[model samples]
Target chain A: MTRLAGRIGRFAWEIALPIVVLSYWWLATADGDNPFFPPASRVLEAFWSNWFDERFVSDFLPSMARLGASYLLAVGIGVGAGLLLRLWRPLGEIVEPLISFLRSIPSAALLPFAVLLFGIGTNMQVFLITFVCVWPILLNTMDGVADTDPTMLDTARAFRIGHRRRLTRVVLMAAAPRIASGMRVSLSVAVVVMLISEMFASTNGIGYVTIQAQRTFAFADMWSGILMLGLLGYLLNLLFVRAERLVLSWYYASKGR
Target chain B: MAPLLSVEGIGKIYGEGRSAYRAIDSVTFDVNESEIVTVVGPSGCGKTTLLKCISGLLPPTDGRSVLNGIPVTEPPEGLGIVFQDYSRSLYPWMSVAHNVAFPLAGKGIPRNEINDRVERTLAAVGLRGQQRKKPFQLSGGMQQRVAIARALAYQPKVLLMDEPFASVDAQTRAELEDTVVALRAEFNVTVLFITHDIDEAVYMADRIVVLTPPPTTVSEIVEVSLPFPRDQIGTKELAEFVKLRSHVYRAVKNRWDDRQPGQ
Candidate 1:
């Protein structure tokens, strides 16, 4: 009984701040005089109804598919380009200025150009999200690959490990920690950019639904959409953290020593 | 017969124009087949530069190194190197057996052959049961054993060791020295060992190629005809060992000191 009580106490510690804020919100909004900010109970009720229905299929699922495809593309291009640039310094020197210049254009500004090129729907969304999020991933992987210990390289060469095998087996493994960290940063960026691009030009996604709810004066629906977006971001980041722990356990284990 | 490995007038000059530095003026030496030759020099004496050129990791500014009749323009396929930094040289991300098997696996050797070599070399280095542990998880000496095992797994024509035992403790260093001495006999591998430790150079080598301070070249080649089965205490106590140790010591230092301290 005491052990169960201790476990409950630890659980309560995590939820304490959320409970306090929620309670304050519920009490303050109980009068229902405000249309812009709905009562907490109504918003929670809408959260269930708005999401656990057809919009879940139409709105949430597409957002997820886009997020998955775009993030994968970003990682693939970022790591591949990063490795290429690191292996060839002269190429990096030639291309880096152009990369920096491209990175500086506010992704919002890049969207219209992208929309004209790819013409709305999945391609545009994937294109915009990947463009915005890939820089951090690329830059981090490049730095990590460049930072590999020279002694390790010499060891590989001395042992007659071929260049391709050396890069894949040795160089890439050494740079994995940094690559993972970059992916972590870019995960959040990818989620945010996905929403923004959806809002700007998407026909149907969580961002489009949320913005539509506000425009149509369905404030409770808007609150529910916001809640679901938060949950989606939280879930993705959680999954990524778990994956990072599994893949880079050695990097962390050696660190603890 | 021609020497199995030859460092033919190897010279290296860093940079060009005003900032040019002569790291190795001219270093020439040879190792007969299955012989252990120690290249002993002081710190900052282009010891590493000389080895890199010989291994073909670094191009000599003038002349070339020949491994069997082939000039070494790239890391020769038949040579293995155990670097000085044991921790850095053994991939920290790999398990003990995996690090040993890396070169063979990289070469697309059959899995069974790689596994056999990995098992044998790990046992040869006294790391028989610790194959699953990562390099960083092991002691400094054990990490070096993984490196040595990695080199030996390949069955190279010549092994290049660069002050490989420098970082371990004295007890561990002594044990590793014995391990190398035994492994050399067991594997019959020619060794081009580089170190600054005079006693080690004398103890481990069949011939000590002592080098001048900087802008370095071979100062002398002192033959150590000490009988096989040399132990640390027993061999160091011998009169011939003492005389040859001091003789090579003077060649490295360019003068004599009676104290005979460890460099």
Candidate 2:
């Protein structure tokens, strides 16, 4: 019962800031005089009507599909590249500067180039999302792998554990927490890039629907689309956090902190 | 027959030029099959450096260490090491059983055989019921026992320990010392144990090698002819045990005296 009460307390603590912000937003937008700030109730009404409609479902599913494919692809490729760099230091030195330079430019800035190369379609959005999300995962994985305790490595070596087993048992386990943290950051990047690419050049997707609504002065529809995107981002972050907790329970529990 | 392991005039000087320092200088020792050899010395006396050389973690600068007629190059297949810090020695993410069975995985051993070996080893270490627990979940002494079990399960020809019991509380340390004595007899494994405690050195070793301060060198080798299946309470009360303990204590004290400038 005490644990339940503590959890309830924590839940209330977490929602307090968001509740205050939402109340302020409702009060500020009551008159709906500002073009940018629509009334909160109007936004909610728009969301309810558009959310269940077939048009919204079609665009939402495609956007979600694109986001999922791009994010998974980025994780696979980024982790692979980071492991390769860790295994070979000379290769890491040669490519590190190039990776940093590429990561420095805003991913949205590459939309025109992406359009030129892959055309303004799902491919362009997928490519941009993958590009933007890869950096954090790659860098974090590299740091995690490199940071494996030398004593543990020596212990592994002394036991004559082979390279493959060592990587799987020791290296990957040690790196999981750091890599999970990186994936959380990368997921947000993936969602943002997905929306940006759709907004830049696309005949479909939630971003395209949002842009079309605004252009046609369908303010309520635009507000609904933006609301949906915000919800999607929040839901994705929560999922990643849940996954991290499941995988890294041992790490946190061991410290007893 | 030759000893199971031999270190001949082994010396290690790290780095070069102005940064160079000799960590171990002209240190030599040997361990007969089924014998327990303990190396005791003050801090920074290159005791750990000597163990590293014997276990093939670090190559000697001037001389060679041979194990079963082969020159020690890398960490040998049948050699196990238990470091001082138990927390760092065992992989934290793996369960105790998995950590123990890790060394036997690719050696053509069957799954059931691996499980049996891990269980038996954990049982031998008095940790039979805690196989599923991760190393971090255990107490410090328990973690050290898991480390020992991991090493023992490897069935190494020689077990090299670097101050394995230094981190635990006094009571746990005594129990672990008893555990090591039991393990030595049970396995008939050649043990090269290192410690800073005089009494522990005399208690756990068949022979004790005392080392001087850095640039460290072996000062004396004391033989402990205590009978097997030794009990801590009775053994500590023996006249022979008292004499040997005092001798080692004085030898260490003398080394400390000699180390001071103009002594």
Candidate 3:
């Protein structure tokens, strides 16, 4: 019971600052509101009105779909290309300069190229998001694969482990901690790039709704849109951390960290 | 009927042309089936390079290694190796059981059979109930035991060990040596063990094969006629043991001194 009580006390302490800030916003904007700054209660009401309705199906779902598809695509291509490039030194050398050149240019700058090639649709947004996120995963995966202990490689070879099993079991397993860290960085990049892509091109999704609300005089709805995005980003990160914890349980246990 | 392994005129050279550096120069030896042979040498005297060549991990620049009358162009399925650095050689992500079972993963063996083999091997190494523990969580000796267990589990006809006990404390090293002695009797596997310590070579081997310094070749092969199940204290006390030890030591020193500066 004391442990439970202590946990609850800790939880309350965690939220104490947030609660104070929210209360200040609520009381200050209770009545006399500027045209730009809507009352906090009205923003909450707008959040429910805009997000709790069927409109959410049209706006929120598309954003999630784009984020999920592009993120999955980036992970697959990044890991595969990373492994391939690391395995073939001559090929990696030939392509390394071009990869570095491409990586240096911002994804937003390539928005025009994407618009010309894929047009201002879901594909364009996805292309941009994937482009933005792949670099971290690819670089980290290559580094990890290259850093696999030579002795372990020799052990696997000496044991007569097949080529495929050696790659998956020995090389991949050894590289996982670095890969996980890379993936974590890419997750945040995916979120940022998703917003950028949607705001730049698509007329649908959360970014579109937020932009649309801001363009009009609906300050409360705009604030609600921003709040919804913050919540979504938080939720995605929470889900990612949970999955990372499960995946890297062995890594953490072995490291005793 | 034939020797289990033959290292006939094997040599290794690094780089090309003027930069070419010979590591092992014509190392030739053979191990009879189920015999424990120790290769004792100075550090950087191509001990590891010779082992790697025999294991087919590295191709010899000069002749070749043969296993059971077959030329070894690749790591033979009938051979297993335990490296000195157990911390790097064993996978950290795997549990002790999984590490032991790894070599058998794709061998088309039944899961139950693999489990049985893993359990049996771990038990033989005195790590029966510690199967679920990770390698890093164990002591240096235990980790080496796990490496040994992994090799033993593979049921290799020939086991190659490169300074396996060099990384552990004296107590653990003694325990592991005893374990190997006991294990050999039960498993009946031919072992080619490498070490820098002459005492270790004498204590653990049936025959001590001494190698000279860089561009190394077998300088001498001193047979150990010491009795079986030799204790650390009793074995060292034996007049025969002392005489054999000195003989092997002098052979190694004589070769080393022959290559001294100005000579």
The alpha-carbon RMSD values of the candidates against the true structure, listed in the order shown, are 3.4, 2.2, 2.5
The models' CA-based lDDT, in order, is: 0.90, 0.89, 0.90
Model 3 per-residue lDDT tens digits across residues A32-69 = 44878788889999999888887689988998999999
Write model 1 residue lDDT over A14-42, tens digit each, in one string. Answer: 79977898899999988889999899899
Looking at model 2, residue A124 earns an lDDT score of 84
Candidate 2 has a DockQ of: 0.77
Mind giving the per-residue lDDT tens digits that candidate 2 earns over B1-263? 89999988899999999999988889888889999899999888988888888778888898888999999989997799999988987987788998899889998989998998799889999997998899998999999999999999899999999999998999999999999888888888889999999888988889999998888888899999987777788888889999999998888888888878888
lDDT of 3 by residue, B41-131 (tens): 8778989889999999999999999998999999998998999999999998888999999999999989999999999999999998999
Choose 1 or 3, whichever is better by TM-score.
3
Selected candidate, larger DockQ, 2 vs 3: 2
Q: Residues A117-220, candidate 2, lDDT per residue (tens digit)?
A: 99989888888999989999999999999999888988988898899999988888888888888899999998888888888798788888898899988898
Ranking by DockQ: 2, 1, 3
Candidate 2 — which residues are off by over 4 angstroms? A1-7, A13-42
Which candidate number maximizes TM-score? 3
Which ten-residue region of model 2 chain A has the weakest summed lDDT? Answer: A49-58
Model 2 residue B57 lDDT score: 85
Give the higher-lDDT candidate: 2 or 3. Answer: 3
CA shift at B73, candidate 1, in angstroms?
1.1
